[model samples]
Target chain A: GPKVLQIPSHQIIDMGQMVTLNCDPVSNHLYFYWYKQILGQQMEFLVNFYNGKVMEKSKLFKDQFSVERPDGSYFTLKIQPTALEDSAVYFCASSLEAGGSDYTFGSGTRLLVI
Target chain B: GDKVKQSPSALSLQEGTNSALRCNFSIAATTVQWFLQNPRGSLINLFYLVPGTKENGRLKSAFDSKESYSTLHIRDAQLEDSGTYFCAAPSNSAGNKLTFGIGTRVLVRP
Candidate 1:
């Protein structure tokens, strides 16, 4: 099975600081997505990226958040001036096709903002 | 209201028993997917369905687009089956994004 790997499985940062979560999606996958899950809540879609551009984003994707996959490298999500409410586990998923395709998800990166 | 709703928020099953988890959708879902999140927090894809059924090992899944629902059945449950099961469907017609259910927690006791 294909795998999506996330770096720094656990992270702790101060509020107002910047943090970048890295995801290495399946090599052949073209569509990428980011989801957020609070400690005891359901996973919520944050954004989806394709062709180096953001295709869609939910309200949860705040202005302080951004995503980019530089030159076919790791897809990264950056949050600047983080807030305490931003504490959650982030999961990355990738699929070969846009619709009706099976997605492979990473184990997730747990971020904690103090 | 939840776009993807799961019933029986939690379940306790004895090893070798059978159990079923269900998801009712408020949105028009053309396809459905099932995943299991282990205690270690790793999510493993279980099935991808399209208005039909699929079986692998002791697990079976079915999706009914007309009825707007999906079901996952675990047969002869094992202790390793203890985890959280989630069902998700595409948020748009393009099937580019997904909306997930709150998930059903299952504990298989020996």
Candidate 2:
């Protein structure tokens, strides 16, 4: 069974600070994705990355948000100048291929901005 | 328009009862996956279907690509099955992007 692991299960940060969320995808997975869920809302897709580049991103992925797969070690999502609205549960998911594949998700990292 | 919509926002069942949860997709979904989010907030994959039915333990799920809908049936529900269930659909044109339903909260009481 494949599993995705996310670090810093819970994070608290002040507004305007920079926060980085790390994800260690399955070793054999080729596609990684980030999803966000506000309290009481459905999960929304943020972005997807593959081949060390961003494949697609939703409108919720703002300019302050960035993702990278540096050194093929960990896929990370960084948010600079975080806003209060950014407070939500961030989930990291990975799949073997681009489409029609079941994705494995981590337990998620809860981010709080004050 | 919501790409995915789930029915019965919340449900409560007595132990040993049976229930069904559903998801309707507005998009041309090529694949469907169901997940259960437990009280600990851990999302566990239940079923992944492509226009077919799959059964595991007391859970059964079916997806119909032509109708763009999916159903999850729980036979003889237990307290451990109490959680939020979500169905996600990836559109044929979206390229690996999944749109999730708002989720159905189920509470099973003894």
Candidate 3:
């Protein structure tokens, strides 16, 4: 019954601009993650965060991308100088623990970079 | 190499039919999770298993950690069951970072 809430269900931005996606994870959840799914493609891991630090990030997590859960509040994924390839549906998810548990995913934010 | 591979990239089934989808993991996966993506692009969690079987309603899922594979069975399929099914595997060393399969798109005809 845990839920993750994603803000701005959809976003359209110009290339080379910056975009910030927000996610409010379950109140007591300890782990947070970001995944991206391009149209007609599989969901790919972007990054995972815990204890105020990034635990792991996949190759797809570009250098211009950053994630933070400042002040134990909402988790955010910021992309600077967004590129065309950044256009996709970004999903935020959280789990009570780091491993072997069901993750609650937000509906997702559809990002379209022109 | 794909860490997780799902079979039958797409399937069409008639109502009341039974079908099974599968995922094979190339990595050392310790846990698996199944999800269904609806027409509106919402990811709905279906099952989470660790080396065993779980059944709920008309759906059943099984994961074998030793063999690194998982299966999802749908019985008495209905039109509402049409969607993209994805299976995710978390590496034993990655601390729950999921590697997803390409997904199987299923369409149930009435």
Candidate 4:
């Protein structure tokens, strides 16, 4: 099972601060996705990136949220001026193709905004 | 307006027993994926399907495109199986983003 590695299992930041979550998707995988799950709630889609550009994003992906993979580096999600409702576990996933095959997910980073 | 609906929001199962969870989609879902979130909060991929069936050990899954639904069956359920199970489908036309169901929490009892 190929693994998608997420850095900093847990992060605590102030409500109006910016925080970046890093994800190391499986090597050779083309599609990358980010999902957010609040405590005891459904995991919602944030955004999906491919070819160094955003493919599609959900309404949940706010204007303040952005994702990028600089120079083929780690795919990262940055939330600026985080809100209280932004506190949740962020899961990173990757797929080798768009055919619903070889989708691997990271352990997730639990972000807490105080 | 819920695109994906999962039934049995919660269930309690006895170890070694069998049970099935289901997902009915209102949107056009060509592919379905099942994931299990353990107590440690790790989302583990269980099955991925495209209008077909797949089996792995005690877990079996099937997706029906014409019916717009998917199913996950657990045989010989174990205590470790106690967790939240989620079924997700890629956006009908986008094929990139996933729309997940609310999830079903299963508790395996000894």
Best by TM-score: 1
User: Model 3, A1-114: lDDT tens per residue?
Assistant: 778999999999999999999999999988899999999799999999989999999899999999999998889999998999999999999988887476889999999999
- Alpha-carbon RMSD to native, per candidate: 0.7, 1.0, 1.0, 1.2
The reply for model 3, stretches above 4 Å from the true place, is B92-94
Q: Which ranges of candidate 1 are over 4 A from the true structure?
A: none
Candidate 3 backbone collisions, by pair? none
For model 1 the local lDDT of residue B34 reads 95
TM-scores of the models, in the order given: 0.98, 0.97, 0.97, 0.96
Q: Which DockQ value does candidate 2 get?
A: 0.75
Q: Distance from true position, residue A14, model 4, in Å?
A: 0.7
Tens digit of per-residue lDDT, candidate 1, span B9-95: 999999999999999999999999999999999999999988999999999999999999999999999999999999999988669
Which residue segments of model 2 deviate by more than 4 Å? B92-94
Summarize candidate 1's per-residue lDDT along A6-72 as a digit string, tens digits: 9989999999999999999999999999999998678999999999999999999999999999999
Report how far residue A53 has shifted in candidate 4, in Å.
1.1
Q: Write the per-residue lDDT of candidate 4 for residues B8-102, one digit (tens) a residue.
A: 89999999999999999998888998999999999898987988899999999999999999999999999999999999888747576788999
How many steric clashes between backbone atoms does each model show? 0, 0, 0, 0
DockQ of each: 0.84, 0.75, 0.75, 0.73
lDDT at A39, model 3: 96
Worst 10 residues of 4 chain B by lDDT: B90-99
Writing each residue's lDDT as its tens digit, candidate 3 over B59-79 gives 999999898899999999999
